[model samples]
Every structure is written in C-alpha cells, then in structure tokens.
Target: MIQTFAFYLFAVFTIASGAITIMARNPVHSVLWLILAFFNAAGLMVLVGAEFIAMLLVIVYVGAVAVLFLFVVMMLDIDFAELRAGFIKNFPLGMALALVLLAELVLGIGAYRAGALELGVPDGTAMAPVGESNIEAIGALMYGRYLFLFEAAGIILLVAMVGAIVLTHRPRTDVRGQNIAKQIARRPDEATVNVKPEIGKGVSL
Candidate 1:
C-alpha cells in the first residue's frame, strides 16, 4: 500500500512538473520545472526498485542535463517577449505535430499491448548468487558485450568536445597569448635586463 501510494505521488508530481516545463513562459522557469520532473521521475524509478536508474536520473539527467539547460538559458541573450510573440502564430503547427506524436504513441502502446512487441529478459539461471551485487553484472555486460559500442561512444564524445572547443575558439589580437615554446627555450640572460647605476652624489642633473 505504501509503495503504491508513493508511486502514485511521484507519478503525479512527474506529470505535473512535465506540464509546467512545457507550459512555462520563462525559459529558466521551464528548466526548473524540467528539473523537478527529473527528480520525480527518479523517485518513481526508486519506487520500482531500480536504484541504479534512479541515481542515474538524479545525478546525470538532473545534475547535468537540466543544469546545462539552466546555464544555457541564463547565458543566452534571448528576447523572451519577442519569442513568445510568435507562439500564437506557431500554435497551429505545434498542435498538429503534438497530435501526430500522441497518435503514434497511442498506436505504439496499442501494438505493444497486442503482443506485437517481444521484450526479452536476461537469462538469470546461470547467474551469480542472489546476494551478489548488480553492479558486477552490469560491469561484466558493459565490458564484455558492449565494449566496442562503449568505446565508440567515448570517441564520439571526444570528437564533439574537440569540435566544440574549435568552434568557440577565437584569437584575440588585442591581447598577446602565451608562447610556451619560446618561454621554455628562453635563457635567464635573454629574459633579464641588468641596469648599471653610477654610485655618485646627486649634485648635477
């Protein structure tokens, strides 16, 4: 009873927050609503005994994804009023796309319920003991079966990072950038200037 109640509570909060995320006029407020939705979704995952997924949702999605959205909204010089002015103009097109998506989702669910989808569970007969950690199992599968895909994803992310850096990189002609090679190759005598002063009384200018 407690579990069911908690599930419903989280589900309700998740749906409400999701609605707020889409309907909010302010971008920052929308991001906040999305973060709230992520939190409630994480709670729902926890209710289902998927602690790993719950933690991932909170740590990765909420912490990283939602925070990234918040940062983007904060940093960008967007005219919200001007953007909202076109909302009515785009409402019909947006509503049509939304309805199409809703129809697709409903059809997918109907197909799934009609046994058109074949979902498979892993064979646990030859698995470890019940007391064994799930992390070990996940690690084994990740490193064994999905190693190539994992490495590919890492490389893709690496390329994306380099591309982002290259895209945002601008050379400023006003300020001189450091020359590491020249600095490393420089001698003390080349860098230091010695001034010689005559040790005399200040009698004449």
Candidate 2:
C-alpha cells in the first residue's frame, strides 16, 4: 500500500539521518543531518495519524530548534582536535550513558509487551467528545483545563527570549548612531549648510 511505502521511506531516512548526524565531523553538517532527521521523523508522525505531533516536530524542532542549532554551530569558533580529545576522555561516560539508555529501552519494550501499566485510573473526561476531531478535542482540553499553565509557559518563553536579546545586545560607541530626538529638534538652518565652495574643492561633511 502507499501508506506502508511512505512509512518505510520516512523511517529509513530518519534512521539514516540520525546515524549521520552523530558521525558527522563538521558541527554544521551534524546540525544539517539533525534537521533532516527531524523532518523525516515528522513525516513518520504524519503517517501515524498524529498530525498535531507532526506539526510540532516540523514547526518547533525543524523550524526553530534545528535552525537555531545550525546558526549557533556556524557562528561558533570550534576546535575539532580539542573536541576529539574531550570525546576520548569522556568515552567511558558516554558509553555508560548509552548503556543506561539501552536498559531503559529494553525495560520500556518489556513493559509494553506485558500490557499497559496501571499508572492511574483514567477519568472519562480524558476521552474526546463524540463527533469532535482530534485537534478540536486537544484545543478544548488545552484552553479549557490548562489555560493558566499555557499562559504561564508563554510568559516564561517571552522572558527567556527577552533575556537572550538583552544578553546578546552590545552598545556601539565607535560609530555614529541615529539620534531621533536631535534630528527632530534641529531647524533647517542648523541641519543644512549652504556653502559655495571653490570649483575644484570638494565640500567637507
């Protein structure tokens, strides 16, 4: 079926890109591969009937996060030799982390095979109302039950964005900057110099 073929295509690209992302020597190339992985992963999300998640994967991860990573990687002055040295030194730590992740994956798979864990008693309200679409249900729940939390998250992100802008902003003293007040306050006589210069001489600013 077309759906199966599309799923396989997305899965293959996602896995390949993820592997390349890690193996890439250049940080910028790695970021590019990571973006590719995010795109394919988003495609897979779409095939699985989770269009909302797919949208988030594309808009949030690929559009914002991956582009930010690419820009940061491009701007940074990195030393690959030093990075390799650090990687060698931290190889054991990395392996240990990988083992921990592997174990978590195995446990998760086992748990799923056994059946869904009884983590909580589900309330009937969690289910979408009849005749409502998935996105509509999600929107209703988000705006209805978690409105304050959503607003708080927005406020937090706004503050973080403002903080980043403030941190990166540098005041320049060497160049003349626009003075709106000074320009507005000036009269025509003060603003313009009506000088008759010698024919061969250039006028000074």
Candidate 3:
C-alpha cells in the first residue's frame, strides 16, 4: 500500500512538473519545473527496481543537464514579452500539435495495457540482485560491447566543444595577444635598465 501510494505520488508530481516545465512563462521557472520532473522521474525509476537508471537520472540528468539549462536560461537576456507575443501568434498551430501528441500517447498507453505491444524478455532471465554493483556492469558493457559507440560519442562531444570555442572566439583590437617567438627570443638587456644616481647629494649622505 505504501509503495503504491509513493508510486502514485511520484507519478503525479512528475506529470505536473512536466506540464509546468512546458507551460511556465518564465524560462528559469520552466527549468526549475523540468528539474522537479527529473527528480520525480528518478524516484519512479527507483520504485520500479531500476536503481541504476534512477541514479543516472538524478546525478547525470538532474545534476548536469537540468543545471546547465537553468544556468543558460538565467544568463541569457531574453525578452519574455516578445516571446509571449510570438507564442500567442502561433498558439493555434502549437495547440493542434500538442493535442495530436496527447492523443498518440493515450493510444499508445491503451495499446500497451491491452498487451498489443509487449516486449520480449529472455527465458530464465531475472533482474540482478539489489546489492549488485551497476558501475561494473555498465563499465563492462561500455568498454566491451559498445566501445565504438562510446568513442563516437566522445568525438561528437569534442567537436561540440571545439565549435563552442570557435563561436565564442572574438578578436580584440585594443589588446595584443602574446607572441611566443618574441617572448622566447627576448634579451634580458632589452627588458632591464641600469640606473645611475646623481653624485652630489648621495655622497653628502
């Protein structure tokens, strides 16, 4: 009973927050709602015995993705009123698309409940023990089975990083960039000066 109640609680919160994420006028508030949805989704995953997925959802999705969204929304200078005006203009089309998506989801759920779209599981297979470590299993799969895909993802992330750097690169006319050759070849004499004191007053002291 307690487990069912908890499941319902998490489910309700997840759905509500997901809706708020899309419907909120403020981008920052939307990001916050998205984070809340992530948290509840993680809880739901935990309840369903997928603790590894739950951890990933909380640690990776919520900690990194949601936080990145919050930071981006907070830092960017966006005119909410202008965005709202544009949204108002496109409201009918957007509403139609949303309704279509909702109908599809409802149909999908109904089909799933009717056993029309059942997934197959291996015979005699069972879930791993609760105390069994996920990191080992994940590492083995990542390094052994999906090594190529992992490397491809790494390359994609590297390219994205390089692109971000290129986008943010700006040439400043006022400030000069360092010249490595000039710095390496610089003479101490050119950089230093010998000072001579005036004779008369110093001698008296």
lDDT of 3 by residue, 1-205 (tens): 9999999999999999999988899999999999999999999988887788999999999999999988988999999899999999999999999999999999999999999998887663333335666666676667977899999999999999999999999899899799999988999997776766687655332
- Which residue window of length 10 is worst by lDDT in model 1? 196-205
For residue 198, model 2's alpha carbon misses the true position, in angstroms, by: 6.8
Each model's TM-score, in the order given?
0.77, 0.78, 0.71
Q: What would the per-residue lDDT of candidate 2 be over residues 1-205, giving only the tens digit for each residue?
A: 9999999999999999999999888889999999999989989988887888888998999899999999988888999999989989999999999999999999998897888654577788778899986788889989989999999999999999999999999999999999999989999999788899899997977
How much is the lDDT of residue 53 in candidate 3? 93
- Score candidate 3 by lDDT: 0.89
Highest TM-score model number: 2
In order, candidate lDDTs are: 0.88, 0.91, 0.89
What candidate 1 gets wrong by more than 4 Å, as runs, is 113-117, 120-129, 179-205
lDDT score for residue 88 of model 2: 92
The candidate that wins on lDDT is: 2
